[model samples]
Target: MRRLLSTTLGQILAIIGCSSVATFLLFIVLLSYFGSPPAPPWPWQNAYRVAGLVESLRGAPQDVRNTIVAAVRRPDLSVRLTSSPSACSRQTLDTHDFDAALRAELPGITDLAVRACTSHKPGETIQVLVPLDGQTLEILTDRTSGEPGRFTGPFYSALIFLCVGVAAMSAWAISRVIRPLRQLSEQADAFGREMSIAPIEEHGPLEVRRAAHAFNLMQERIMHSVQNRTRMLAAISHDLRTPLTRMRLHIETHRTDIVPDKLIQNIDIMQSMITSALAFLASDTDRETREWLDLGALISTLCDEYAEGGAAIRYDGPEQIRFFCRPEAIRRVLTNLVDNALHFGRTVTVSAKVLDGAIQVDVSDDGPGIPEDRLRDVIEPFVRLDHARNDRPGSMGLGLSIVKEIVQAHNGTLRLINRHPSGLTARVSFS
Candidate 1:
């Protein structure tokens, strides 16, 4: 219920309802103050006039009564001599206004009363009583002479139509505002999944357009920075390769007895590191197009390749599960995570499953897991925990870093957690 009220539709409805009620009440107050200019005299005024005429004719002769009755009688109104009071019920009468008007118009008359009663027709009729010297005179008037204490049918119908029209207009204006915000949110989500998404259209109200414009500018700046960094890395790689090549040629020319094997191995390691660094940096300069692929099959293929190489790698997942992603990038990420697991553990397990609208892939190993404190630090580029953990040859520590970047590019998350009793588990999840 709270969430429902917080929505845009709920707020708009609340505003419309409150405003309509307030405006209706304000209109009633104004009408009462100024009064209905076009409306005829109220029921009380008509009753008072008839009562005054009757009071003046009190104690007059029968001839005088007949003459006055003939003058005052009409199709909708009549005055008559009666020995009993009016038969109409007093419950529905507006006695306050009726008695006040009667007192103002005929101060000498007392024991006055007024009532509204149903007639043979569809509408109500007013009954006014005035006591004479020894008899009671009755006055009956048309329905229009009494106020019903409620708005007329037409008035209520018009009020309803006004409220509905105003509500529709409010909904339209609110939708216009909310539509742009919804578009902006969708664009942001797309950019998170793929940085190459087109810029958001600068439209709608001023605030929305300004936000879109700012987002586009920020995206351009980030792309520019990435491009600049990739170019610098490429230049550095080219400049260093020439000197390394020269040193290699010079070593080959020297005698083997003087130049140790370990020294040559060191130079080869440096070349391999340079190559890996260049590859990693170059990946940032290119955009990978995403496509739907079988994620389970990809993981199974990686497991098969490793098994063929005599590694204890097993896959536990469905036969095929399709997902949209950059195939090559995801493949590289899975390969690196599997290789890293194999390096520390004798047995490596790769598994995939769909959970909560997302795809989760887990790579687990039976080796000693990384320390809890160093879990976050190990994913940083060139970060090595060789001093604390087993030192593997030719490991530059770029594997996990690359995996993190690829997973993030797909709007996914990667987490490394120590397994119970022993080993480590690396889990990646993406929607």
Candidate 2:
């Protein structure tokens, strides 16, 4: 049952079954309390039976009437013939809603007398009465069942056949609907753990086919982006190396302390760029296992380390905020955000806390923040804002992209917002 309920077809069938039972119960309630009892078997079966007996006994001789009663009586049914009045024995005060139904069945008859009366034996009953030519016929029958006569053999058969037909149609329709979604989910799971995957087939309803098509396009775009980025990195590596080679050759020919110090700074910048580029292409953070860590302390220690290195960085918020994520990946994200902060701003403030049922960490900097228009673009790969702010060495524009990828892998979001006057806040939030 548990396995059955897990599927869409089973759930729908369960609902139908429950609804059928509810409807049946409602019918029983209406018949028992609020309305009249159901007609027995057919609409006018009892009336017709009594009418047949009346027709046979009309103006018959006394001996003939007795013969007919003996011939027609059943084990549960009895018939009586009399020309006497007051034939009913101890009539009870039961409601007579069925009297109108009896009259309606036999249009030829204008009036009929009927009553409920006690029986000699426990199962005997007063079925009904018939009036004939100067005679009365009383029908007494044994009660067939102690329970209410609500269902018949044909009714049960119909209900079973109806349920089977409905279940078959529902299972077919639901299976057709669930098939594509299940395939899409399986493909997604495989792709997240894999880089190269064949495109998923687009089939099903319009929305499902469209979603599959969009996913295929996204995979192609990502594959293209990776190839383009690798080519760009190779070109950049050669271009930057030519100048460094010449600068080294110059230093060898004419050595000066000042020249070498400035040149070394440029060399450091070049190395930073190369390292960041290679790391971005490798995306090693994707393979890390997730674990719970004290994010608050991690930010605090990172701020103190930067502060010791003469950068104006501070940490705030709680002492411990346990968050589930890849520690190294989160550290990489923090490293990139903080690097951008120190390069552009004079001071950096790193804070972490639980906000709105999510783990939120904000790295704010009082630097010349990114232009409002370019905030979104800065997060994309290889985007540099040279015109918006002063040129920072080794700013290859891959840091935020790496950060975004790592955050997304953890099912988190990275949002860059410019401060009011002159700063930016990088907010990382996840539940």
Candidate 3:
């Protein structure tokens, strides 16, 4: 029953069906109590009642007829003797069978006038008048609507029935409207525990569809973020171990404790990795907040810093290229690309450009480019290219993988292409 009621059609039918049956039951109770409305006194019953009253009056003396009428009179009825028939002021009822049934009981009467009192209030008042030996006898009483009272007949019954119908219809309509939202809530509960569930379907009214669409987007983004963080932790750990291993081996080999230039670079590299990872993880913006920055200025500063370190690097393209992006994350991406290029190639040239509505930056190196077959594998985390670049002091094959992740986080794309003759270029583009 719970499963059935959860559906739209089932709820609608149940509501309407229950209300209808309840109304019918109510009507039955009213009928049994008030004895059928509007047409209460059956023709034979009314005929017998009127016939008995008339026969009693006819047999009683003129003086005692008034006493008999008074004794039999009720609040809903009035029986009196009159000298003229028009004194009752009653209209004839349009029931031929009732008139014939009355005649069948009272055959002695030649002039029979059934006068009915029309009332707009509660019970129906019926008047039956007949001519006697030298007087007129009028019997006035209720025919239908037992006991003269308001809210007792078919009118109130119909009103109650109508209210039931309207209530049922309203309930069904509301259920249909909120059905999608209910599903949304259920999906949210299910996905809250395990985000691997498939996205809920977007449907229903326009506003509801928009809400569902937003939920789907949030679900996808949260799942992607979790997976990305998991990968980042594993990859960063693997990368950090490389430097730690080198430091350990150096510590073991040179027992005299002389820190060489290559050993210092590895320490610096490990420190940089831990610092960058902490900053990325602890950032309030989840990753980093995007803001407008001068791409050319950033690249120029980086190249100048590399040059200051006695590394051959140059900056090309426009002097100022303003772009919107996460400053720290994008800086990391560019730094990784430039470091990788410097390790493999003789000199690194960083270029920036704004074409169409997008920003493009390329870090090109004039050295042996990566092989076509290994280009795809080079982007995987902890995947080192089988080339001479692996001989670099602090290279752990994390540069391109880090660059790829950062680029993707910025809603950008990264591509590695072999330059003509003898070079490689790493291109990053964003709109």
User: Which one wins on TM-score?
Assistant: 3
Instruction: List, residue by residue over 1-431, the lDDT tens digit for candidate 3.
Output: 88988876668767777777787678657744522223434566767767888888888888888898788776655677888744335443323344556777888775786655555233335667788777777766555433334345676778676867687777767777778889999999999898799998898889999999999999998997788578768867777788888778877787555658658888888776666555445544334667998888988999999999999999988888888888887777888898888878889889889899788999999988888988888886546665734554434455676677778877889998999998999999987
Query: Model 2: how large is the Cα RMSD against the reference?
Result: 13.2
lDDT of each: 0.75, 0.75, 0.74
State model 2's lDDT.
0.75
Give the alpha carbon lDDT tens digit for every residue of 165-283 in model 2: 77677778878977888888898888888868999999999998998999889888887777758755765775487558867776787868567776877788788788877887787
In candidate 2, position 10 carries an lDDT of: 77
Cα lDDT tens digits, model 1, 1-431, are 67867987778778888998888787667645422222325555565567657765875676688688778777777778778765687544354455556666676777767676675343336677777766777777655544544567788778777877888888888888878778888988887787787888888999989998998898886775576466546544654565467557668888666456646665676676666566566665138788999998889988999999999999999989889889988988998899889988999999899887789999999988888999999987666797656865445566787788889888999999999888999999998
Candidate 1 deviant stretches above 4 angstroms: 1-264, 284-286, 391-394
Show the colliding residue pairs in model 1: 43-145
Candidate 2 stretches greater than 4 Å from native: 1-218, 227-231, 234-242, 245-253, 256-263
Better of 1 and 3 by TM-score: 3
Compared to the true structure, candidate 1 yields what TM-score?
Answer: 0.44
lDDT of candidate 2 at residue 122, scale 0 to 100: 53
